[model samples]
Target: MTTTRSAADDARDLPAEPTAPWILVLAGGVVLLWLGVLAWQVAVLPERVPTHFAADGRADGWSSRNGALAFSALIPLLVVLPMPVLSRLVLWAPGQINAPNKQWWTATGPRLRRFERLMREDLWLITTVTLLLLVAGQVGIVLAARSGGDAMPTWILPVALVVFLVAIGAVMARMFIGGRYAAQPDLD
Candidate 1:
């Protein structure tokens, strides 16, 4: 016997929870906070600031204070600004989202909603962590410069990159495995 399902039934099965507001707020707050820190630091920064660091964390290149400050401000903006927009796009147009089992997840309204929520949350978490690391690195650099130190720990950047990569890998693995195991709701 073939069973028939209506769009209403499918919609009813979808989770009702909207995107988590705290995630967006927290992500935005981090970006704003770091931007403020950058701006404040720039005011008191010396004439020349370290723009490049050697593997040992020693300053190898210098830029005008304005240039260094601009570069610092750009980092978080580059990393954090596009994430929410992309996340929203994923919700607005699931057909455009590229993922391993894309068709299966986007096959229904409920599945698509779930997928969008998962993707948005994942992006927010990743964006927040990355921004925090970047902000910390900038703060360290500025503090070192203020103290007349020519070197910041060389390991900061490498460690941050490794952590970021690992976090992304973990999130992707979780999504792929979860998607593989998720029960596909019958649409018939």
Candidate 2:
């Protein structure tokens, strides 16, 4: 057999084995946990629950108990579920995904699968973090509702928000750096 571009011409290097996250398995559990917690809290919540909070953690906005419950439960699912779905879309339609090397990676099956696997894990990570954040907010809201005052602890949701944002950045950084491995796509 013969090849072009001398011996220097080699196929692209494949990426590292994808490390599947165990928490990914618990995604369903988290959603269920949120539902359970929301149900328990909503039962005890006043007719009006805090829908919005101020910098000082005061209840700045209000909504009906059912409204709060519906929004809280639905919003988290709406937000967290999409990323995983996008991951699947990336697998089905790699062309829609934006990576470092779009053409070479998607040009072959192995390369595209590897990219999709890594992306699936990355998106799952984001999804898991988002679920945890919403859980924290639910707990905080419950605590605020039970509090003797109209304000929460003034640190719970804010801290959770900051942590969630940081986590999102870290996952994105991992995608840009770790997901963008240098190994050639094919390694032929």
Task: Point to the candidate with the largest lDDT.
Answer: 2
Model 1 Cα lDDT, one tens digit per residue, 1-188:
98886433464466654667887788779878787878777677788777678877888888888877877777667757567456556555666778777767666667665666676687777788778777777876776577587677766788877887887787677767656426456531
Candidates in order, TM-scores: namely: 0.71, 0.77
Off by over 4 Å in 1: 1-17, 25-29, 91-93, 178-188
lDDT of 2 by residue, 1-188 (tens): 87553111111234434556575566767778888888887678888787678888888888888887887778876777787656556555665767787876666656665666777677778887888898888888788877867678878877888999998888888778775644563543
The residue ranges of model 2 lying beyond 4 angstroms of the native Cα positions read: 1-21, 25-29, 179-181, 184-188
What overall lDDT goes with each candidate model?
0.70, 0.72
Compute the lDDT for candidate 1: 0.70
Tally clashes: model 2.
Answer: 4
